[model samples]
Target: MHDDRHAPRKGAIPTHALKAAQEIVVLKWRRTSFKRLDGSIDVLDDDWSLSIGGRSLARIYLLNGGPQDGRWAWFVQVFPEGTPGNGGVGVDDDGRAAREACESLLPPAIQQALADGRKSETN
Candidate 1:
């Protein structure tokens, strides 16, 4: 019998790479909170992850922000999970406008992480 421990769990993104991709992947929301330890307490948001074939590609969150015209909510810190990249792709207005932004962002982010991992393996 095959073990199911390695199988992806709900709201959990596999940080480890998988053998192959099987279907249309998406980002799943996870509980998020922000605390201050000398930093701003206003930083808070809901977190989400994009996983493919049980492997995490990127992580994003809707950040708390002030009103600016018709915008307020911001999706910032688009970074690869597990290793290498520790910064964001860029900040964008959350909700409808941000959807396509992430769609375009995921592929390249995952590819870069995978490449970085491979490079590290050779060193």
Candidate 2:
């Protein structure tokens, strides 16, 4: 992951410090494909804050899954408000894979928070 601790990375929006968020929402689920994938795990959590990291990562309402490479798959749209690449759909065999993939695309600071092993109330 790119380190931009001193400088704010473009499209990288920081949330209201995980320590301060209240009333956060957490969602987790999985989807299976009879065609190709066995299943995929997904986890999404976000605070009431409208900020990038504060909002839920899974945009299931906007998800549109289909075959991407001869294999049937579902895509969970994440970080809709972030820069084009900073946040986008994460494709995986299951929800967890998809969630981790999307989480990997988060801003550097958020990623660091995750690395630091901080637990939010939502978690």
Candidate 3:
């Protein structure tokens, strides 16, 4: 919760943070066919990893069957070879929170690349 009386004037977590609304965050994630390290394409609706479009970005996953069902998971540099990743807590019933969580974990460069990719596609 943001303490309106003492929170920083320029930056603060909004009161609606708990709801995790799509409007609160501005990230565009398209469903792309995820290619495994073996180069096999697995295009499952529940598979949230959709190539963040950058150098060695993590592959974000939406948990469906595991104990952490409705949760999200990610790992850095999940391209050819990767690094350790992060996971989301609580349940994300609609995946909006997972998308927001994934966006938060993404590197700035990848996010920028995604923006740039959108621009080029429109041209």
Candidate 2 per-residue lDDT, tens place, 30-121, comes to: 22212336566343332111133434433322234455433212332334333333255444555445556655665454454444443543
Indicate the TM-score of model 2.
0.35
**Residue 107: error of model 2 in Å?**
0.1
Q: Write one digit per residue (lDDT tens) for candidate 3, span 1-123.
A: 656774433422232431232222333454547579999987777555544223223345577676877666554332111222332233455566655555555444445545565676678
The candidate maximizing TM-score is: 3
Which tens-of-lDDT digit does each residue in 1-123 have in candidate 1?
989875555444344343222221432433344457877554344565545554444455666555533332323232433232433454556554544455454445454444554465678
Lowest summed lDDT window (length 10), candidate 2: 43-52
Clashes of each: 0, 9, 0
Q: In candidate 3, which residue pairs clash?
A: none
| Superposed Cα deviation of residue 104, candidate 2 (Å) | 1.4
Give RMSD to native, each candidate.
Answer: 13.9, 11.7, 12.4
Model 3 backbone overlap count: 0
Worst 10 residues of 1 by lDDT: 18-27
Local distance difference test scores for all models: 0.44, 0.39, 0.46
RMSD of 1: 13.9
